[model samples]
Target: MLLVTGITGHSGRYFLQELIKNKYEGPIRCTVRETSNTFLLDNSGLKIEKVFGDLNDQDFIDRVMDGVEVVIHIYNIHHSPNIVQTAIEKKVKRVILVHTTGIYSQFKYASKGYKLIEERISQFKNDTKCPTSITILRPSMIYGDLCDSNMSKFIKMVDKLRIMPVISRGNSLIQPVNARDLGKAFFTVLMSPEKTVGNAYDLTGEMPIKLIDVFKLISKELNKKTFFISVPLSLGVLMARVLKILTLGKINYIEKVQRMAENRNYSHDNATYDFNYEPMSFEKGIIIEVQEYLKKKEGSKSK
Candidate 1:
């Protein structure tokens, strides 16, 4: 039996689908918070058990880990560390912890909540008493049909405004990994215990592209004309403050955009060499995302 946390999230949902597609015979279980909407996984043809529980509650963690052998910890909230500790206590030896690249770079400008979560993850790794063999998987800007990530937001902004707001020079490079590829990599790590235990890998797509090029690709895919508006760093900060004042600022997204504009590149060399992880090209991922977006748009128009 395998327990998957964050089952409603982008990577988690795709991971579940991919496991089913590959004909995985193991029983799967997932945890959802009180308010989580998990109806989408109900008829997925896999033996799935959805348990309502809070990650912070030790008893809830124990209940969720009962009869579970391996656990994929993907929830990025305040109680993540507690949940991981509980998984270890339950004798769930193999655990995969999915983190984000934001932990490395975006923390500089992230809200206190984000900073605390990152700190907890680091502390959990440092604690030797936790007997679980953990593999930390960090990915950057994951995108797929179900994702409304930075890439998707960029596409929508381009569609609406016909212009992209470049925070600075827009020369910073980013490697956006497809959600499906990220799922595959997660499964591969979980399956190979000896090779992945206690190792951390940074995952990304096949190519590292500049921010401008990324927007250009989306524009091309959507057949939309794009104009680049270069906003100075100081002005970008000021605009962020203004948005926050207006109750319109998404701290995570704003911080990530600022970081990318300033250049934050994660090396995937370890991931590629260790697990033979090869992600699809950025262009291919964008094409698939565009097609899915178009389908959704058309469906909504018909309604």
Candidate 2:
């Protein structure tokens, strides 16, 4: 039996898709909180057992771990460390932890609260002594259908306002990987335990490009003209704070922009060498995303 946490999330859903496509014979179990909606998985051909409980509760964790052999820990909430601890206690043989690349240096631009979370994750990684084989995957910005990350928002803004926001000189480089590719990387690592265990791998797109160039490419794809405006970091932070005061700042949106402005690079050589991980090109991912967006817009118009 294999357990998948956060089964409804971006990467989790991708993982499920890949698993089902490959026709893995093991039983799959997913854990979700009370507020999480599982309707997304309805009618899907994948055979899954859903466990509803608070991940922080050790008893609940044990219940989900019953008869589970390998576990994929993707539930990155406040109780993530506790979940890992419980997994160790349950004696699960293999565990794959999907961490964020932003948890590295990107936290410098994050809000105070997120920075603390990053610190805790780092501390937990350093302190863990579990006998189970663990592979920590740190992936860069992930974009795909239904994604609302910085890239998606920028695409929407370009379609709406016919302009793009460029922080500072817009020279900061970003390696945005497709969510499907990220899923494949996760699946590859999970299947090849020996090469991945006790290692941390960074998964990123094939090429890193500047923020300005990214927006321009999207604008070209959308057949729109983009007007670029530079905003200083201090001013951007002030604007974000003001937006928060007005309840207008989207939690993940502001944080993503701030992080992108920092121009951090995540290496993927370890992942590539270990599991033969190959992320799709940025252009390929963007093309797919734009097509989806267009289809969605047409559907909305028809309705």
The top-ranked prediction according to lDDT is: 1
Residue lDDT tens for model 1, 44-100:
777888888877677888888887888888777456677677777787777788877
In terms of TM-score, the best-performing candidate is 1
lDDT of 2 by residue, 39-82 (tens): 75554666778888877677888788877789888767455566
Per-prediction TM-score = 0.87, 0.86
Give lDDT per model, in order: 0.78, 0.77
Angstrom error at residue 267, model 1: 1.6
lDDT for predicted candidate 1 compared with the true structure: 0.78
- Where does model 2 exceed 4 Å of error? 33-47, 106-129, 241-258
Cα error, candidate 1, residue 41 (Å)? 3.8
